[model samples]
Target: MKVVPLGDKLVVKRLESAEKTAGGILLPDAAREQPQQGRVLSVGDGLMLPDGTRAPHEVNEGDRVVFSSYSGAEVTIDEEKLLILNADDILAIVR
Candidate 1:
């Protein structure tokens, strides 16, 4: 199924988190933290302003971004986990 976010929302898919420590010690799933980084999948047009003008988004689809730990709402789409976040919730775009 195809997903198209609406009204300043973004559809993002989380990237894989590290499975090993810096010292090469492998960590089990129970010991791993939820990933805060994700790739932009779909984006809304823009936010509506009081003047009825739409603000352009800074990020685009395919951009890798970082968000707060509890930023977005999680959902399962097409049997894959995805996140829906507001544009303001996205902290940074990874270069």
Candidate 2:
């Protein structure tokens, strides 16, 4: 399934959390924390402006990004989990 975000909205695929700790201790699924980082799967055209123009987005497809912890809505498409969030919610792009 393909997803297209509209009006500054972004479609992100959350990166997988680490399975083991720094000490080499394996962590269970229940003990793992939800990752706030993800890859830019799909990007919206831009934010709709009142004057009738769309604002450009800084993030692009294939760019890894970090977003707010509590931002974005989680959705499941074709058994794959994804997140839809505003461009403003993105903190930084991973190098």
Query: Could you say which candidate leads in TM-score?
Result: 2
Cα lDDT of candidate 2 equals 0.96
Error of 2 at 22 (Å): 0.6
TM-score per prediction, in order, is: 0.94, 0.97
Per-residue lDDT tens digits for candidate 1, residues 38-77, read 9999999899999998999999999999999999899998
Instruction: Report the Cα lDDT for candidate 1.
Output: 0.95
Model 1 residue runs over 4 Å out of place are none
Q: lDDT score, residue 30, model 2?
A: 100
lDDT of 2 by residue, 1-95 (tens): 78999989999999999999999999999999999999999999998889999999999999999999999999999999999999999999999
